[model samples]
Target: MPILGEFREFIARGNVIDLAVGVIIGAAFNDIVKSLVDQVVMPPVGLLFSGIDFARLEWVLKPDNPATKANELVAIQYGAFLNTLIKFLIVSWVVFLLVKAVNVIRRRDAQHPEATSSAPPPQEALLMEIRDLLKAQAGREEPPTRH
Candidate 1:
């Protein structure tokens, strides 16, 4: 197939669309989680650690030159890293919970198959029932009788 045709085929798959939507929502969710970590979760934790702002908590590997302010300060921002780690944990926990819930629902649907829309149509179901009945009747040793 042509390259454009292949691209079209790829885009047409349901999984691709689902993945695109997931990525978009995940980005938005990431922002929310970041805000929660920055505004709500980190403040009390920082207060407990005696007024340390994680974003500003950095070690100056190379001090800035006060003479001319020519060379900028280079530092390792470990506090920001800690905040990011907390955000990662929160997001992971949420995703885990969502997956667990989906699995539970999936198991319930599997056990009660009719709970989902995967059941055959009424016409197909009736045909299957008739086929089974015919098979059972055919297995009998008795001859058929006309009513």
Candidate 2:
């Protein structure tokens, strides 16, 4: 097959498509969680902590020098790290919830296979009914009388 056709077939496979979709959704979800942590969640927490800004919370290793126009300044931004940690935790929790929901749906569908698929064909249904009727008749038959 041609290279284009081969590429098309690979992309069309279920796992590949699902993975691509997952990556896209994960990226978007990460962005949303990051935004929530940065804007909504942290602000209130910071306010509760005496209006502290987490992003600006850092340790200066070398102070900035404006006399020599030297931009050599280093700092450890532990607050930013905390914000990122919170975002990660939130995203993890959301993923866990989603996975739990999917597992529940899978279990339910497994328990009731008919829910996921259409009913048996008419002939199959009729055969099952006949088998049940024959079993019923066999059960109803009287035992042979003793001599």
Candidate 3:
């Protein structure tokens, strides 16, 4: 019972909830970026490179076994490695763009907050009224009025 209560308290924390949400969203974002790279970026680039198959790019680490066919020999997947590197770069660029967009939105919101339509809080209004009254009283009670 004590352990369950502690676990419940920990799970209810704002930071923990936020972190869990971030992880879920981040995974979804990674999938979108991967799809964009594979579908949008790689095809055009591959076409530009004389229709080269990026994934098939490789360096034979061991001598080719012509007897067992090319499929039988072990080869280092340098092309696939290159493809992965390109995918990494694309994902990073996309994440950078997303962060930049978020920053721009934050800046815009800071400049023009949506809540500007609301009136000042009651406490602030009271403080302002008190300040104005004090200024008026000071003017009325100056030396000419007091002497």
Best by TM-score: 1
Model 2, range 1-147, lDDT digits (tens) per residue?
999999999999999999999999989988899889999999999999999999889999988887878687899989999998898899889989999999999999999998899989999999999999999998999988999
The per-prediction CA RMSD against the true structure, in angstroms, equals 7.6, 10.6, 9.8
lDDT of 3 at 114: 70
**Count of backbone clashes, every candidate in sequence:** 0, 0, 1
Q: Estimate each model's TM-score.
A: 0.75, 0.74, 0.62
Best by lDDT: 2
Candidate ranking (TM-score, best to worst): 1, 2, 3
Model 2: residues >4 Å from true position, as ranges? 119-147
lDDT by residue for model 3 over 105-139, one digit each (tens)?
88987898874467899999999999999999988
Candidate 2 vs candidate 3: the lDDT winner is 2
lDDT per model vs. reference: 0.92, 0.93, 0.84
**Candidate numbers, best lDDT first, in rank order:** 2, 1, 3
